[model samples]
Target: MDYFIQQLINGITLGGVYALIALGYTMVYGVIQLINFAHGEFFAAGGYMGVILLNWFIGRGYMSTHPMICIGASVVLTMGYCAFLAMGVEKIAYKPLRSASRLAVLLSALGMSIFLQNAMMLTQGVFDKPYPIELAEGSLTVGGITVSYLQVIIVVFTVVLLVGLNLLVFKTRIGMAMRATAQDKVMSSLVAISSNRIISLTFAVGAGLAAAAGIMVGFYYGSVRYDMGFVPGIKAFAAAVLGGIGNITGAMLGGLIIGMVEVFGAGYISGQYKDVFAFIILIAVLYFKPTGIMGENVDDTRV
Candidate 1:
């Protein structure tokens, strides 16, 4: 039972990160029907940004005096940087291809992914960049099971982010415009909604979420790497597909499920095939129900 509880905690923590990254994929897909394969790079960039900012703070001696402030600054700056970067990517790489074929857009996204990966490698090098400070220290133990403070922070932040996203999507005027654009671009244009702006906003928001996830992962794992986005990106894509490609709630559900599956599979079965669990579930879902668990209208999503 204790073992189960421990694995469960670990799974939840991992899921929180997955859910954040998955949100980026799902949101971009939801808004413009583009996969934005480069989204993972945004995650990597965010991690690097966080570490850079945090390290600067540490060097200036601000971290020891004001750790919380330093952390907050890093999160804000990293998210902002990544959000703007994603917006620029959309404008430069994706905007011109809007009228092009889906295949062309897909290829462009892939190309951009490679470009960003190489850019990060050239700039940050191929080595792992260690975080300068630990935001959460120690752990809480209960019933012979232990949970780290970092895990608690990650889960809580994820829940808060999910709630905030729900409000943004369902309650805001911008969100309504986004939904309209997603449902029917022509009709949305006729209704005086600027689809281009909405689409850009969607990318920015998704990138912000991905950035947050990247920073959390850096703190959790103690280091960030230029190529760190690849695996989690793929897993998050799988999670998005499992939940429903364009569905926000579905993305969250899928992320949690994938996290649990991977963690439990590793704990009870074998760590060697941990990634295989998510892939198997993805394949199974695609074979059985391609539309996903809570998915509706495979093309258009309420996100």
Candidate 2:
């Protein structure tokens, strides 16, 4: 039972990270109907930025005197950096192809992904960048089960972000604008909602969330690599599809399910096949429910 609980906690932490990344996929798809393949590059970029910022803080002697504040600042700065990066990518790579064929836009996204990935490799080097181990050193143990402080922080932060997103989408005027634009870009533009701005905002918001995840993942794993985003990005994409792309709630649920499956599969079976288990579940969901769990009501739930 303790083992199960331990694994469950791990699963939730992993799932939350996936869900954060998945939101980028679903949100971009919801608004523009285009899958931003470069979304994962934003995640990778965030990880690198976090390390760089934290190291800078350490060099300036801020980390020793104010560890929590330094970390908080790093997260905020990294997120903002990625958000701007996403907006820039949208303007440069996707904007011109807005009216082009879907294939053209998709190809552009793929090319951008490759370009960004290579750019990171060239700028940050191909080696793994290690996060400061001191940032997440402690763990709490109870009843023979151990839970890391980093896990708790990840889960709490995920919940806070999720709830904040819900309020943004359901309560605020901006959210209403988002929903309206998602429903009908032309109609929303007729109302002076500025579809282009909303689209850019969507990209910024999604990239910001993915950036946060990247920072958290770096803290959790103690290091990051330029190519680290590829596998997790694929898994998060799978999670988005399983949960019904464009449905926020479905994405969260799908991420949790995927996370749980991967953790349990690794714990009980072979660790080497964990990725296989995650994909198998994704394939099964695709076969049985192509529209996804919440995708049946896409018009109502999108954005």
Candidate 3:
């Protein structure tokens, strides 16, 4: 039982990271009906940015006196940086192809992904960048089960972000406009909602969330590489598809399920086949329910 609980906590922590990344996929797809293949690059950028900022703080001798504040500042800056980067990518790569064929837009997304990944490789180098400091270093043990502070922080932060996102989407005027635009772009434009602006905002929001995930991942794993985003990006996309691509709630559920499956499969079976297990579950889900676990038509409930 204790072993089961340990794996469960690990699964939730991993799931939270995937969920954050998956939200980017679902939100961008919900608003623009285009899968941004370059979305994962934003996650990579965030990880690099967080490491850069934290190292700078350490160099300035701030980390020793104010570690939490330094981390908070780095998180905010990295999220903002990625948000703007995503908006820029949208305007440069996607906006021009809006009226073009879907194939053209998809090709553009692929091109952007390749370009961004290579850019990171060139600028950041192919070497793995290690995190400067550990955020939380302690652990608690109860009933023979051990839980780390980092895991608790990750889970709590994820819940807070999820709740905040839900409130923003369901309770705010901006969210209403977003939903309106998603449901009917032409109709929403008729009401002066500015579909273009909403689409850009969607990209920014999604990238910001992915950026947060990147920071968490760096902390969890102790280091990050320029190519780190590719695999996790694929898994998060799978999670989004598993939950229902355009549905926010579905994405969250799908992330957790994928995370849990991977953890348990690795724990009980071969650790080398963990990635395979995640995709197996994805394929099984899609085979049974083509729409996904929460599959629904693109409507007001989406996004």
- TM-score-wise, the better of 2 and 3 is 3
Task: Rank the candidate models, highest TM-score first.
Answer: 1, 3, 2
Better of 1 and 2 by lDDT: 1
RMSD of 2: 2.3
Residue-level lDDT of model 2, residues 1-303, one tens digit each, is 999999999999999999999988988888998788999999999999999999999999999999999999999999999999999999988999989998899899889999999999999999999997456768999988999887988999999998988899889999999999988999999999999999999999999999999999998888999998888888888889899988888888888888998999999998999989878877887777767888855443322
Worst 10 residues of 3 by lDDT: 294-303
Question: Model 2: runs farther than 4 Å from truth?
Answer: 297-303
Per-candidate Cα RMSD to the true structure, in Å, reads: 2.0, 2.3, 2.3
> Which tens-of-lDDT digit does each residue in 1-303 have in candidate 3?
889999999999999999999999999998988889998999999999999999999999999998889999999999999999999999988999999998899899999999999999999999999998988999999989899999999999989989988998889999999999888899999999999999999999999999999999999999989989898898898899899988899999988988998899999998999989878877877677757889785444322
lDDT of 2: 0.90
Q: Distance from true position, residue 163, model 1, in Å?
A: 1.0
What TM-score does candidate 2 get on C-alpha atoms? 0.96
TM for every model, in the order presented, reads 0.97, 0.96, 0.96
Backbone clash total, candidate 2: 0
Cand. 1 TM to true fold: 0.97
